[model samples]
Target: MIGKQLKPNFIFEASWEVCNKVGGIYTVLSSRAQTLLKEYGNKLIFLGPDVWQGKNNPDFIEDKKLLKNWREAAAKEGVNVRIGRWQVEGKPIAVLVDFQPFFEQRNSIYRTVWQNFGVQSDKAYGDYDEASMFSYAAARFVEIIYLSLIHKNKKVVYQAHEWMAGLGMLHLCKAAPSIATIFTTHATSIGRSITSNNKQLYKYFHGYNGDQMAEELHMDAKHSVEKQSAHFADCFTTVSTFTDKECAQLLEKSADVILPNGFDNAIVPKGSAFTAKRKAARKNLLRVASALLSEELFDSTMIVSTSGRNDFRCKGFDVFLQAMANLNSELQRQSTENCKTSVLALIEVPCWMKEPRKDLQQRLAEKEIPNTALPNPYLTHELYNEGEDAILNTMRSLSLMNDRNNPVKVILLPCYLDGEDGIINKPYYEVLLANDLCIYPSYYEPWGYTPLEACAFKIPCITTDLSGFGQWVDATLKHRGMIENGVEVLHRNDDNYFDVAQNICNTTIKVLNANKTIRNKMRKNAAALADKAQWNNFIKYYYQAYNFALSKKLK
Candidate 1:
C-alpha cells in the first residue's frame, strides 16, 4: 500500500512555455494549471520568460495588482518582471521575467556554471544562450521571492520543465538548498537530436553514450545542463514510463516518479453544446473542402486528420502520406462501383508558410461552391520554399493528385488554426471536434498531445506504440488495435515503415466501414479513456513527486 504523501505549502513551476504557446509543453502546463490552482491557490506561481513584452499575448492577462509588492522588490533588485494571470480555466498567477540584461554577463555566468556544475557552455550554439539566460533570470526571480515572502519553515517545491529550464533547477539547488527542486524532462535534448538525425535510437540505445551522442549532434551544452539537472535535483521526474526509460539510458538517471501529462476535461463541450459545436465543425470543414476542391461533398463524408509539429520523419508524415496513397489507390478502385465513401484527410501541421493561397481564398469567397478545381488544390497556404516543402514533395512523390473523382482527398493547411488561418478560421479544438478520426504515428513523440486532445473530443485516433500516450493506452487496455477501444496503437519501429503504413490503411478502412452504433461506442470509449487521464486523477503523481522532493529537505 502507498504511504501518506506530504503536500507542498507552495509550488513554483517554471517552463519556457508558461505564457508562450509553442508546443506540447504548453498544452501540458496550461491544461493542468486549473487543477494545481485549486489545490495550491495563490501559492502556485508560474515563472516564464518575458518574450511578449511589447506584444499582446492572448493567453495572458496582465494585472499589476496581483503581486505588486514582489514586483516592486524585484525591480529594486535589477530584475524586470510582468505579473499576470494566465488566461486559462483557473487564471493562476504568472511571472514573466525579462532575461535580456543577463546576456551582458553571459560569459562570466557560463564560467561559473562550468566551475560549479561542470555544465559545458563552450560549444553551445543556437538558442542555448537565450534559454540559459532566461533560466538564470527565472532562478533569480524564484530566489528573490523565496527570500522576501515565504518563511523558511514552509515546504516549498520548485519544479522546472524541459531542458530550457534546467539551468534554473541547478541554480535553485545551490542558492536555496532548503527549497525542494524537481526537474521534469519532457524530452531529452540528445535523445531528440539522435532520432531527428535519423539514427536508430531504440536499436542502439545501450551502445550510444549520451555525451558522445551530444557532441556528435552538437548538443553538448544543452545535454550537459539537462543531465546534471536530472542527477542533482531532489526529485527527477518524466511525463511517461517510456520517457522514464529514455531518461535512464540517455540522461543516466532514472525518474523517481512518472508524472504523465493529463488534460482538464472541463474544457471539452458536453450535451447539446457538444452536438451543436461538432455539427458546426463538420459543416465548416466540409464547406472549406468543397470550396477548395470545387466538388460537392455529401453529409456522409468522413474527416480524418494528422496534426502536430512539422517533424516530417519523427511525426511520421512520410508514413501518413504513404498510407493515404495506399488508401487512395484502394478507394479509387472502389470508386468505379459507385461507392460514395468520401475521406477528406487534412494535414493540419504548421510549416514555414508565407500566406494563405489567394486562389483558395477567392474560391472560398465565391457565393456558390464551384465545380471547377483551383490550381494546386492540395495546399491551402503558399509556402516560402515550395520545392523544399516536405509535405508537398511527398505528395508529389506519391502522385497524390487531389482529383475531384478520387474518393480520398488531401489538403495541407500549413498554418496554425488559432481561429484565423484565413481559410477554416477555427480554433484547433473546435476543428478537432468535427473529425471522425485523427492519426499521429510519431517515431519520436515524448507524450503526444494531438492524440490526447483527439481522445478528449471523443474522436477515435490512430497512434504508434512508440509515443508516450500510445504506451499509456496499451497499459490501460489489455489489447490495442481494436477500434472499439477508441485508439489503434500501430506497431512502429526503425524497419517497419511500410508495415505501419499498411496497418494505418487497414485501420482507416475499418473505421470508415464501421456502423454508427459501433462508431458511437468507440467515441464513448475514447472519451472514457481520456476521462481517466484527467488532471484530478493524474495530479496525485505530482503530489507524489513533491512529497519525495520535500522528504529530501528533512534529510
Candidate 2:
C-alpha cells in the first residue's frame, strides 16, 4: 500500500540553530546533513542567521567563490549573506544571512504577517523581535535564490524549524506560493511554559485553551506565530508522537508527519577504539573525582551521571537528587553489613557559574588525592547566587552532603564540558563514554537526545514514560523494563514525584548489583536500540514530510 515518493528538485532549510550550536535542533540539522547532501548535493541550501559575523565560527567555513552569482544578486537586493559550507559531515552549502537590517522593518513585517496569517505580534517580547527579523530575512533570501537561480519548472521546498523560523515559513507561503513549506515544532511554546510555570499540563491538558494559556503566560507572540505556521505551512511536522498530541491539543493542528530526531552513529567510536576511549574517559573522570573528593576511585567504583540544561524540575533534577539521597541511605544501611558499593554520581548540568572552584583547581594541580574534603565538596564550580540555587537548596534539604565516608558521593559540575571547563577539561561525549549509566528523567521532554546519545555510546540509561524517547523505547522493547533491556522506561506522571524517585533509586541499585554478564548484555542491548535510531533509519520520515509538502504544492 505504499504510494509513489515525491521529491523536491531543490530544498531550502532555515533554522535559528543552523550554524549555531544551541540545543537539540543543531544536532538534528548537523547530524542529518550528510544524508541530505548524498541525495540532493548542492541543491539543498541551508539558511541560518549570521550570528557569528566577522568571527571565526568553527562550525562554518565561508567560501566567496561557491555562490558568487547568487551573492551578487542578493547584495543588489540588500540581502547581506555569507555563502559557505557548514563544517559538519558532507560540508553542505549554507547561507548565513545578516538579519540586523530587517529589524528596521520589523513593525511593517509584523503587520504583514498579521494581515496574511493572523499571527498576533503586538504582545511579543524577549527574542521575538530578533527571531522574527532573522525569519523575515531568511524568507527574503529564499525568495531571491528561488527567482534568480532556480528555474520555474523545478519544485522547491523550504523547511523551517521551531517558532523562531516560523515567520519565514509564513513569508514564503505568501511570496512564493509555488514553493512548498514545512514547519517542524520540536516543542510547543505553551506546553513548555505550562510545565516551567509549575502548572499541571497533562492533568488539565484537555481543559486549557491555547490562546488563553498563551495570554496568561505572556507567550502570545511566539505561540501565535508557531500556530499560524502550522496552519499555513504546506505540511506541519513535529519530532515525536508526544509532541504530535501536544500540537493537536495546544495548537489545534495535527502534524502531517512525525519527524523523530536521529543521531549520527559515525561520530561514535567502534570496537577497540571504543574500548580505549571509554577507558581513557573513566580514568579522566575518576582522576577528577579523586582530586575533588581527595580519594582514589578504582575500577570497582560506579560512575553515574545526568546532564542537560538547568531546568531542575523539568529535567527531573529534583527526582535525580532524591534518588541519589535514597540510594545513599540504602548504601549506608548496607554498609553495616561491611558491604562496600562506591558510587560517584555526577550532575553535569550547566548553570550560571562564576568560575571553577579554586581549591579543586589547587588539588588537581598537586596530583595527589587529599585525605580531607574541600569547601562545598558537592559543587565543582561556584554559583553566581548560591543562596537562591534550587539544586543546592534541595541537596541541603535532603541532607545529602558530599561526605567523604558516604558510599554515594555526588558532584555538581555546573559548566559546559567543552574540554576547557577547568575541572573536567574534557568534551561532553568524551566524558560521557566513561559513565556506567546515564539518566534523563525529563518531565517535559519532547524528543530526548541525551538518552539517545548515551545509548549510542553503549551506556545504559533510565528515562521516564513522560518523554518521547521513553515512549518510543517502551514500544520498541515491548515494555521490558530497564537494566535488562538497556533502557528502563519508568512510568511517570504529574503526581508521582516521590514514586518516580523511588523507582529510579531501585533501578540504580539493581544496575549496581547486576553481574558482569548481565551488565554486558544491557550494554549490547542499549547499543542495538541506538542503532535502530540512527539517521539512516529515521531520515525516511523527513523524506515523507518533503513528499507531503511537494504533493500539497502540486495540488
Candidate 3:
C-alpha cells in the first residue's frame, strides 16, 4: 500500500535548492510556499540541504539531534544521514543530511563513479551523489514520519523537485509502496548539460569536467532515478507545458499534468507610480555604466536589460550582447543624425561558484577570444583552441568595450533579492522600468520567466520562438502581430547572427520610436497579459494532479 501520512492534507516537499540557496527552484519554493501553507497548513513539510547554518542557530540544535538519530538508525542499513532545518522567510524547512559527509569524504561517491565508468559529455549528468543525498534524506524523513505515526496513521502526498529529490521519492515509494508521490522537474540535467558541455562551458559549477570526466562518474544512476520518479509517481507535473514534453521524452514516460510556474505579484510593486522608482533606478544604472565606460552619458539614452544566472551562450545573453554591439558599431559608422540614440545594456548574471583550480583555467581561456569571433559560423568554437579563445575574448570584451552608437553596459548582480533592498538596487525590475527592451534569447528554456516579468511592468521584451513564453505569445497573438508592440519573438535558427542582431536592433528601435499613443495601448495590453497569468490558475493543475495521484493510490 502507498504509505499514508498520519495527518490530513500533508505535503512532503524535497528540493536540492530549498532552504539552501541555489537556482530558480528557490524562487518557486519561496513564492509558492504561502499557497501550499494556506492549503495544507502545518502539515506541509519542506526538505532541502541546509548549506548555510552555524552552531549557535536554533535550527542547528534541532538538526544536530535529527542528524544524530538518523545517523545512528541508518548505520544498521550501511548508510549515513545528515540532517538540519532553518527558516527562510519564516518557513519551516528541513536541511536533510549534513554536507560535512560529502565534503569530508572529498565526494568519494563521485570518485567511485569515475573509477567505474569513463567520463560522459554532460558534466551535470555524471554526478552520482546528488541523487544519493536526495534519496537518503528523503528516506530518513519518511522513516521519521513513519515512526511518528506508529500509533495513528495519516496520509502524505510526497512531491519531489528535479532528480536530486527524485532519489528520496524513489526510496520512500519502495519503503511504502502505496503512498502517493508527485515529481516536478524544474529543468532537466541532460538538456542543460548537453548545452554546457558541447559548448565547453563550465563556469557555473566548480570542478565540473566536460563529458569525459562525467562519463567516469555514474550519470546513469541519476538518469535512472529521474526515470523511476516519473514511472513511480502517482502523478507527474512540470513547470511548463514545453518542459512537460521534454521530461516525458527524457524519462520515456507520459506526464500527468502541466502546472506552470508563477511569481508572486506582491513582490512587484503596483501601478505606473512605480515609474518614479524606475526613473531613479535608471539614473543609478547610468552612473554605474558611465563609471564602467569612463564616459558620461550624452543625448537620448535607451537602457536595455536582461538578468539570470550567467549561461550566456544558452540564455541568449551572447546574442543580445552581439546585437547591441552590432547596433553600436552601425550607429558609429552612420552620420551624426543617424546615430541619434545611445543604448546601454545592464546585464546581471548571478554566478554561484568562486574561481579556483581547473574552473579558473576554463574561465581564463574563455576570456581570450574576441567578441567578433563568436558570431562567425566558420570560426565557431568547435576546435578546442577556438572555443577557449572565444571565451577569453568575450571576457576581455565584457571588461573593456564601449560603443558610440549604443554603449552597451553590462552588470553582473547577485541573484538573491529581497524587497527591503532598494528597488533601484535590484537588477531586473529596476532596469526594466528605465530600459526600452528586455532580451531573452534562450536556446533551451522550458518556460521563460523574465519575459513575463517584463510584460508585467509594461516593458517591451524580446524572447526567442523556442521558449514556452514565446510560443504562448504566438498562440495569443495570432491576429495581433506584436501584442500591442510591447513584446516580440525571434526565431533562433531563422538566419545568421547578423540577421538576428539586426532583428533585435530593429525591434527595439521600433518600440522606442513609436508615438506615445501606441505606447499607452501596449501598456494596457501588457497589464492584461500579466493579469491572465495568475498563480491560482497554475496551482489548480497541481491540485488536480495530486487528486489524481491520491485516487490512484487508493485504488
Candidate 4:
C-alpha cells in the first residue's frame, strides 16, 4: 500500500521543464506547486536548468536577494546559479542552474558517472550531452546544499522528473544517501521511440526485450541512463499505471507508487466570472476565424480544437486532420444542417512560426472585417516552413482548405497562444473555454494532459485508450462515451488508426448536433470529472511516494 504525509520537509523537485513552458511535465509541476508550497511552505524549492541564460524567462521571477548566502556559496564552489520563484500561481521558490560551463569537463563528468553507475555514454547523440550536463550540474548543487548545510534531522526529499533529469536523480542517490530521491519517468524513452518509429508496441509488447529494442532503435545511451536512474532512486514513481507497466517491461523496474498528474482549478473563474470570460472567449474565437477566412461565422457554429506539441504521428495530428476531413464530408451529406456551419476546427499546435499575417492583422483592426479571404486564408500565422509543414501538407492532401462552400472550415494557429502571439492575443486556458469540443487521439502518450485540461474546462473531450488519462476515464467513469456524459474515450491500439479516426468523426458529429439541454448536461459531467481530478484529490499519492522514499532511506 502507498504510504502518507511527509510533514516538516525540505523538498527539492527538479525538471528540465520547471520554469520552461515545454510540455505536459511543466503542467504537472506548475499545477502542483501551490499544494506542495502549502505543505512545506518556505522549505519547498525547485531546481531547473537555466536554458535562457541571462535572458528574461517570463515564467521565472529572479530575486538575487532570495538566497544570497546560498548563491554566494554556490558561486564560491563553481556552481553557477540563479535563485528565483517560478512565475506560476504559488510563486514557489525556483533555482535555475546555468549548466553551459560544464561542457569543458563533460568527458570527466561522463567518466565519473560511468564508473559510479553503468551508464554507457559512448553512443550518445543530439540532446544527450546537453540533458546529462544539466542534470549532472543540478545533482552537484543538490549534493552541496545537502552535505554542507541541511541538518541531519531535517527530512529532505528530492524528486527528478523524466529521463532528462535522471542523471541528477541518480547523482543524489549516490552523493547524498540521506536525501531521499525519487525518479519519475513520465514516459519511457524506449517506449516512445518504438511507437514513434511505427513499430507495433502493444501487439508485441510482451515479446520484446527493453535492451534489445534500445539497441535496435539506437536509444542505448538514453535508455541506459533512464533504466539505471529508475533502479537506483530510493522511490521510483510514474504518473499512471499505463506507464508503470511500460517501466516494468522496458526499464525492468516497477514503480513503487503511481503519482498521477492532477489539475488545480484556482485559475478557473467561478460562476459569473466564468460565464463572462467564456462569452468573451467565444467572441474572440469567432472574430479571429471569420476575419482570417473573410467569411462571417454564425454564433450557432461549433468550435472544435486539438492542441499540444507538434509531434505529428505521436500526438496524432495526422489522425485529427483526417477525422476532420471525414467530418466535413459527413456534415455535407446531412439532410439539413442545423448549425450555422458544421465545424470550425482549430489546430492550435505550435510550430515554425514566422509572424502573424499583416493583412490579417489589418483586417482584424478594421471597423468591419474584410469580406475577401487573405492569402493562405486558413492559417493564422505565417510559417517559415509553409511548403513543408506537416499540418499544411495533410490539410492539402485531404482538401481541407477553408473553401467558401465547405461545411467544415479548418485553421492552423501554429504559434504559442501566450497572449502575445499576434492573432488571438490570449493565454491558452483563457481561450480554451471557447472550444465546443476538444480531441486528443495520441499514438504515444504517458498521461495525456491535454484531454484532462480540456475536460477540466468543461469541454467535452474525445481521447483514446492508449493515453493514461483515457485509461483512467475508462476504469474510473465506466467507459461511457455518450454525448450526455461529456467525455469519449475511444479504443486506440497500434493497428486501429482508421477506426480511431472514424470514431472521432462520428463522435464529433453526434456531440456537435446535440441540443442546448444536452450540451449543458455534458458540460456538467465534464466539470464533475475535473472536480475528481483536482490536485487536492491527487496530492496524497505524492506524499505516499515521499513517505516510501523516507522509509527506504531508513531501511
Candidate 3 regions with alpha-carbon error over 4 angstroms: 1-8, 55-127, 150-153, 199-218, 271-273, 298-300, 333-341, 352-392, 395-400, 403-433, 478-485, 494-498
lDDT of 3 by residue, 259-366 (tens): 777655656666666877777777766654443343465425777777765676667766776676666565567545634336666665554413212322232244
Report each candidate's C-alpha RMSD, comma-separated, in the order given. 1.4, 1.6, 9.0, 1.8
Question: Could you tell which candidate, 1 or 4, scores higher by TM-score?
Answer: 1
lDDT of 2: 0.89
- For model 1, the run of ten residues with the poorest summed lDDT: 332-341
TM-score top scorer: 1
| TM-score preference between candidates 1 and 2, better one | 1
CA lDDT of each prediction against the hidden true structure:
0.89, 0.89, 0.59, 0.87
TM-score of each predicted structure versus truth = 0.98, 0.97, 0.75, 0.97
* Least well predicted 10-residue stretch by lDDT in candidate 4: 1-10
Pairs that clash in candidate 1: none
Superior by lDDT: candidate 1 or candidate 4: 1
Residue 534 in candidate 2, Cα distance off native in Å: 1.4
With candidate 3 superimposed using the best TM-score fit, by how many Å does residue 398's alpha carbon deviate from the native? 10
